[model samples]
Target: MTDTKYRKKLLMALLAAVLMAAMLCGCAGDSGDGETSASSLDGEADAGNRDNAEETDQNMELAGSEIGREFTERDRDSSYTESEAVQIELEGNSISADGRGVSVSGNTVTISEEGTYVVSGHLNDGQILVDASDSAKIQIVLKNAEIYCGTSAAIYIREADKVFLTLAEGSRNVLGGGAEYTDTDENTVDGAIFSKADLTLNGAGSLEINAEYKHGIVSKDDLVITGGSITVNAVSQCLSGKDSVKIADGVFVLNSEGKGIKAENTDDSTLGNIYIAGGKFTIRTEDDSLHASGSIVIDGGDLIVESGDDACHADADVVINEGTVLVNSCYEGLEGYRVVINGGTVDITASDDAINAAAPKNASDTGNQDRTSRQEGEMQPGGEALQNSDMPDEKESLDGEPQNGELSQNGKLLQAEELPGRELPQAGGMPEGELSEDGEMPAAGGRRGGQMPGGGDTGRGSIENDSNAYIKITGGELTVTAGGDGLDSNGSLFLSGGTVCINGTASQGDSVLDYNGIAEVTGGVLMASGSSGMAQGFSSSSSQCSILRVLDESQEAGSTVTLSDSAGKTFLSWSPAVQYSCVVLTSPELKLGETYTLSAGSENLEITLDSIAVSNKTGGMIQNMP
Candidate 1:
């Protein structure tokens, strides 16, 4: 073997070794990349599982919190068996007969025995039925509890003595399910507390009763809400008491299909009284807002009633002494036996009569007869007769018979004292004095009698005019705008004090001051205007007549003048003077082809241009001036 051949063989061997090592290293690098990819996939799966677990834990916590705060547990042993009588005590604390911190799951708790039972916790929840079974005497007090009854009333008491259910401070009692369909017919959940006894609510609490079919609070006796906020969204009556319902103070919001508050007595002898002394009451109903068979008295507090029917309907008197009462009704605003408004700001907007006090048609026939008799004449004590002896006699008297004279003449003789001294005339009836050259009587003792220089009717005094009806303005500034006659009275109109501005239009085809009564303005300033066309400014037909006498006897008098009546719109004006005139007509001087805004005092005068006739001589003629 040659030396070069041996060296070549060794080099080939070394090269072969290096190539094998390179191939093994490449295979190992590929295996490491696959392991890294597998590890990253596992880490992503673990992170996703952790996030899901956290979300599930959060949901469970929320559910637990809701359940813990929503309801309190009651022991099962505390359950009252069917027809079993149990007595529970409550003194501003929670208690259940089943046991403390135990939930009640039962059929019914029949209160058959007559005793006072106090329930501090939630009364009816989860089929825990409490049936009074028509017991005559039973009482239960529910304080600080949430009672929910599915397809049943939370608390039902029939013929009970007194069921005092008091919601704790900052707590509420919610009744009925959340469904749009009303369950009034069947399976209806009624009020949170329904009682046959005298119902009373006190303290700072709340009762939210949503009855889709029945009343929110129904009581056979008196229902007194002294304190607490009560909300009733009922399909029927909200608060109904057989005797009376008195609200002293609280926030009561009632939305009912029927009456908002009803106090109807079953017996005719017993009168139901609905008195709201103090409280903020807001009622929106489809029917009467506040109805009582006896009477309704609102002494204080703010009351707002919006009803489709009458806002307030009372069989007896409806008295509003104080408070702000706003009523917006489709029908009559207020209907009662006698509505006496002593104090209170009442704003009523009604489609029908604003206030009606007519006697009910269902009143007794004897009552109707008595009312008629009272209206006919006045009654004295012991029913004594006070005849109308001052009535005017409607008889005519003939001439008295002639006294026994010397010749027994049939006609009476005229005495010298009875005749005028200066008068001397012959049988031909010529004046004893001489006449002027123009055939006129002398200025001294003329052909007729002693007369003034001018030939005018001097026998008639200054004629006075009267208004339509007697309008007594005692106090308060009033501004009246009447579509018909301004203010009509059949008697004397006395204006004691206060300012009155009347803008009234007369009847069509009638005079403006077609008054049949006296307008005796004693005090206060009066500015009145009427319609146009043959309408006198002020007219009186009485013998005494309508005289505008100044309050201060020394202040003199004035005349009521008609300034302008352009297009049947009469504007009455007045000016002061020593001697008053009956009516003064003024023709306004309107500019040619220029508009003018005529005003009386501070009020704008309503004028019609068509009724104005522009005269080339004077400015224009306000035709048919009042």
Candidate 2:
């Protein structure tokens, strides 16, 4: 008999033994054919028996080989027969099959009804393909076996009920296109491990997944990395999921050209949630290191992110209650809606405003409306006298009573006493001091006098000018080094408390500095010093010209006139209030390097000077000399 016929009989014998074992467990008997009816078993017996049988079957699937033994063997020289059954062992072992067509090297390795399986091992340089045309399940227990794919993934489960790839403590799985020199236009398969099921990584293990085009681990369901060291280096997003990718506790390092870990959902209602309760994660990417379209809550973990863009980005809120997050980015460090720093120290420095709040729209219009509404509410209908009913009669008469009932003549009814004494006379109306024609005040040498209105007496009028603005140093220490007015405010400057030191020059080097605001000293101390000698220390240019005059007689005395320009150049000098006889030195008009002589009643004064500063209007000194 041929080898194919011999293996066919052996497989049939193994199946017969398995069928007998199933029947002894109260399963339905098989009809001489390979078909068995599960409906004939007792209802409760069927459910309980199937559960126990499958559990026992999975455990006893591979029972024979020891470490470093061949898990299965297949005939590479002959055609496959129906009775050829590949035997798989549970111990550390390897498998070998045909290189071109479908080959099996396991006890009960089922495949998808219409799919192909490409299995490769690491210890050998050969690959095998197994094709199954019926719906079946395959469970693989890798122990001390090294699997490598030449140009495809190590294990490909196209369409199967389930595919289990387990790596023992000392086993490895490597998948990469073999080192070649051709740059052809052929599809090169990458990615170490690829699965289409809910992937779970448990036990103390290490998974190093490196891909050129795709990600390290691609799954359709949730990818849960419970406890393992998973290092994924991919061109695309490192670890992504259609639903969510959770890292409960593990050492996950992701280096990707795209986002390190992206959790997004197409549907808004089924948004993904990236919850990192505990893990040691380090992510470095060219884009946002950690991006989540949904919410990202880092309750506790060690996440270190370095990216070219925002470190941690989320479409919704990102709450960081407790964790040591060190982020260094070229752009904004942390950006989100209503960013609340309840705890933790976040040191951020940007080229622009470090921390900014969005400004309110229509700010000017809102402020104007608020002011107008406040003023309208404080309005009163009548004057003060009309509102006070308890005012005495003498007080009422003093205001301007209707007395001596002669109708008070024609135009004299409203006398001076009818108005307040603080009211000044109008320009073209009756002058309160001296009246002239057309009820106006007379000019200096114009009309003399006119009788006072209401036969009231007129006295000599007096005018006092008390219009000087000042700046008061209130609370707090304010040091001002400004180009213009040191401290200026339109309203009253009440310096309740604080110290203000102002070091400001009026012009370039001119000593005459001006303070355009009211400087009041209610509490704090103010130390102000001008540049040099340009007259007024601090002066106001307003109509109420407030000025703090610094009179230095020690510098300006006996001035057989000492004059210094803005460049500190001493120009011309002469004596003022002197009886001149020969030449009167009236305003020297000295130029650069020019000297002049003045004779006052036989006493000659000789003055020598250098470059005169025309910009500063500096001439000569005036003094009472012989």
Candidate 3:
């Protein structure tokens, strides 16, 4: 109670009043202002985020491949008149020319100008040579004409814009070649009908060709067949068109020692193409049946091929829009980098990869280093050459195996690729250390990469493991039975729609479906059953899929596999589709985590999971099915 205590109390009361005034001003003036400012800022940030999301959605798209591109460069106009049919009769070693532009010199009947000539009679040792203007189109009508060339082609078209070989209605024609060809300084004519210009064969009648030299029909340019009934028997190749071979309608029976029908232009990558719109072909060959470089498109046909190698092979894409292809026996059924089967009824039985997507293999596909400087030539029967006066002056062999840089199968300008004993079988026929002079193994690998014998670097064989191969099916009804992988894509496999039944369990070393990249099944009916070791299934990145594994016991062959919903509604079913121990079923109808029953005959499998389907799958061995 003094003067100092009174001053201390007054100061403390003033300090408390000052603090209260500051608190009241803070609460009443701008305490909620920060929240209002932040609300506007948050709204601006959200607007910016929405714009980014919309921009991202617009920029996303899937890239397409070049597997199913349309080939529209086809010639369908072949209507020519046979006015003033001149007659040319062959007698012994001389020819009687009765045509306007025909002349006879020794055993050769030469046509020097453009005209229509009707040829009938037998030529024992002679030829019909057409040497006309560059723009002229010569038509030769065969009315029961039988010609045999002892040293050259029976019909030699040395120069012209194009030549048409027409078989007269109700007439039978024959053109045959000998074993030893008359080799010129720069050329060797080895086909029964050899032409330097574009050649077309059309008629409603039948013609038979026996090519004992090299090929049956050889054209340096394009070769087309509109309508005919033709049969070819050749020692090397049956029909070889350098630029392109387009067949609209024909009944062909081609039996060859090397290849059936080929269009190979190694000089120009886009020139070698084959388009078959309609035909009835039954081809038998020791090598590829239908081979090309650019593309192979079959619109509609009934093709039954029995080949030693691939049935249908192309370096580029192979598109089968519509056809009935039945490859009865083959090493590889169908081969290409991009194989697209839009619609077809294809049944193939192969010893190797049935439907393989791979890059082109050259003679240099081998790892051997001694590929260059290998010379190949056609030797006579007794290892000698017999010269003739009717030979060309520029014949150089196109190596026994194609080098992927030159046209190798023509007897007119580009000399045919000829070797000794080209007709012999080569599977496991070569010695272990000895190689063929063509720088290839006789037959080394299964289906692909068959080694060419000797120090040669090329041969028909298995495709080396590459990563650019793929298969896309838009629509088809394909049944592939393979001894190797049924459907093997070195890259990814994409299916939008199709009904593919693959029976690839014919071999134990491969799978039913072996893909190196993604295997996506968006919309399709895929029943692939094969070896368990390499039977990789669809990728998880696919949309709405299911994986199932049956346990307790393995399903036997010839059993029906049926799937149903919990309410006894059947969704998908397959009977006697394939043989397998470990099976993986994937489809869009599989509801995730749903209970379903899968039965193979009397064997039942029940599975319930969180996703479209469930499985307790363990890997098994790959064994060949009976």
Against the true structure, whose TM-score is highest? 3
What TM-score against the true fold does each predicted structure earn? 0.44, 0.35, 0.69
Off by over 4 Å in 1: 1-107, 110-144, 150-152, 177-192, 366-626
Give candidates' CA RMSD values in order. 43.2, 40.8, 25.7
* Best candidate, lDDT: 3
Candidates in order have lDDT scores of 0.41, 0.33, 0.61
Name the candidate, 1 or 3, with the larger lDDT value. 3
Cα lDDT for residue 348, candidate 3 = 91
lDDT of 2 at 471: 27
The best-first sequence of candidates by TM-score reads: 3, 1, 2
Between prediction 1 and prediction 3, which has the larger TM-score?
A: 3
The residue-by-residue lDDT of candidate 2 on 175-220, one tens digit each, is 3323321221242323344445444444344556555655556545
Better of 2 and 3 by TM-score: 3
TM-score of candidate 3 against the unseen true structure: 0.69
Evaluation by lDDT, superior candidate among 2 and 3: 3
